[model samples]
Target: MPVRRFVPIAAVVLVASLAACNPSATKSESDSKPAASASAGTDRDEAGSSAAPGAPAGGNGLSLSEAIAKIPAADEVRDGYKRDSFKHWIDEDGDSCSTRNEVLLAEAGRAPEQGARCALTGGEWRSYYDEVTVTAAGKLDIDHMVPLAEAWDSGASKWDADRRMRYANDLGAERSLVAVTAKTNRSKADKDPSEWMPPAQSAKCTYLADWTATKLRWKLSADERERAALETLAEGCSGTAVKYEAAP
Candidate 1:
């Protein structure tokens, strides 16, 4: 893997607030899914310091094992899933850049030239899933680390439209949405670590950590096989630690 340069990007304000957006929502609706120890999300660095100006950051010191252990395990609900159920790629911030463009700009190894309407001309990106180097933004796909279909299966099926939309376009945590080659993104589709792992040998541990962090961040559930797979894979990732902020 090449040494990549990550440029800082602004934190997008997706909605006014999760509570304000959903007036009728109850505390249980917001808190019911999280495990006791992994109930919240915060963005803390390795040194366990503060987050950026507007970004929500905090401490989730759980090792990969503990993080995986806190994920609620339940049977998946796969029926009645529609790709459109979760709206994505919108410019919620009205910054001319959509959620996809924000990810592209943030993840680009070489920053792309931004034009009117956020047209990206040239940039370089490393598709971590396959470790493929891509210079064209058009060739990269913004992947939901936790696929929408997978989220729906886990626990999103019961969420209202607004909450589902937040999950789909989440920009709160860097791990939630990733930029990768379209090929690798398509290959991953909606399969979890249990069914698919990254082709890049070096990406496996980071991939597992990110996957676990994303699930815990949103308080999403896991099925038995998926939970077991995460636990089994986590043993090899002893050096990796997960830190995520609870999505508001």
Candidate 2:
């Protein structure tokens, strides 16, 4: 496969023309389905200020402090786990675009030509995981912020199939699913924050915030070692914040 390339002038011009053709063609994170209702046994902090099951507290989501506090720590269980357990890439809204295509459309810096059946021809995107700029959609992977295996180990092993599906196909938050270079996504395969981090140093803060927020949103637990790693990383990310709606 070809390495990252500069955004071609023709692609830029094409995107601009598309924007002119349809003023509302641009997509945002909120365009996805409504927030899932909070579950009955939702966890909350001691202070009772975090019980509300809704979108992230702040417009940006949550501060590192808030996100860390929300995570429930527990021993992980990996029994009978399989990647196939979480069914993903569904066309949730009946649009031709699946979850993967929706992410590509939402994250693309320059819009691609949408052929029949939501086939994306050309676009530009920056893989924040490694700071690589890619033009071909084929070269990018829609990464689950918290990998499926990691989620199962953390707390998802106990969740029902429906909840797991919601977690996998989540598009309610911008930080949940990301478009990154295929290389970086594979390299990060199912590792927690303790085991791996983004290659781009500048992305570390945002990466941690997203990871933490995703865990809290889904009510997933972190093992002692993983929590320790996140706390240590949080120390360096001083004013950074995470924004995500709690996954129902």
Candidate 3:
């Protein structure tokens, strides 16, 4: 298999490793999909990163995994899942910064080793979600894999704002709104997988696994068009090593 590449974005933002996107923005009713840069969709730059442990960054495009799609939809459990149930961005420790700040450290490659107040003093970001590479952490945004409003539409409206925030700021079990190129993040704002895809064509397989796992875990599903698109992508990943579920 060919190796995958990591392409940096236009105006680079320096970081310890992963970028630390500010978490103060309010949710928009319309732009639930990832944000798109003016350059249009994802910009696949031909750069590469040292392979992370999991699966090799090369494989087939999007595809469904029985394991990932197996979770039964818990529309009932999500009944009272308001945006306020899960308190987010709070100081996980008694430190000054919030959970979001901690994520910058955990995800970024350049973050400092130890600090009481956990500020992401050092790191650099390389967003795979969008082909555009981000050097400076602040320039990028920690995008929610599934937008709030969209989640609401999918059955999160009943959830308190706190619960919504937890999902938005989820860093556990690989669930999160990770840092990615602003353009790609915007383009993926609220739309489902059926609507758009990353500019990096090589990452289709990884993207599909992540998407499928998240949707399944959250008890969410794609609408008619969205489901069809996901199913189509899954067909391409039929015989690859891509995992549809995060390991225990």
Q: Name the best candidate (by TM-score).
A: 1
Candidate 1 positional error at 39, Å: 21
lDDT of 2 by residue, 1-248 (tens): 11111111010000121233111223222111111211111221112223234655443345576678779989988898998899999987776888899778766778889999999999888777777889999999999989999999988899899988988977654556788899999999999989999887756766776788778778899989999999998887655544444555
What is candidate 3's CA lDDT for residue 196? 77
Local accuracy of candidate 3 as per-residue lDDT tens digits, 1-248: 11111231211111111223111222122212222220111111212321122321232212245534453443323344444444566664455756556545545545544456654545665566654545565677766666665576676666556666656655442334456777887888767677877777655654665566555546664566666676778676543222222221
- lDDT per residue (tens digit) for residues 9-50 in model 1: 212111112232111123232112111111112221222233
Candidate 1 whole-model C-alpha lDDT, 0 to 1: 0.67
Task: Please list the C-alpha lDDT of all candidates, in the order they appear.
Answer: 0.67, 0.66, 0.47
Worst 10 residues of 2 by lDDT: 6-15
lDDT of 2 at 37: 11
In Å, residue 66's CA in model 2 sits off its true spot by 3.7
Better of 1 and 2 by TM-score: 1
- TM-scores of the candidates in the order shown: 0.78, 0.76, 0.61
Candidate that scores best on lDDT: 1
**Segments in model 3 whose C-alpha atoms lie over 4 Å from true places:** 1-63, 67-88, 112-118, 239-248
Sorted by lDDT (best first), the order is 1, 2, 3
Where is model 2 more than 4 Å wrong at Cα?
1-62
TM-score of 3: 0.61
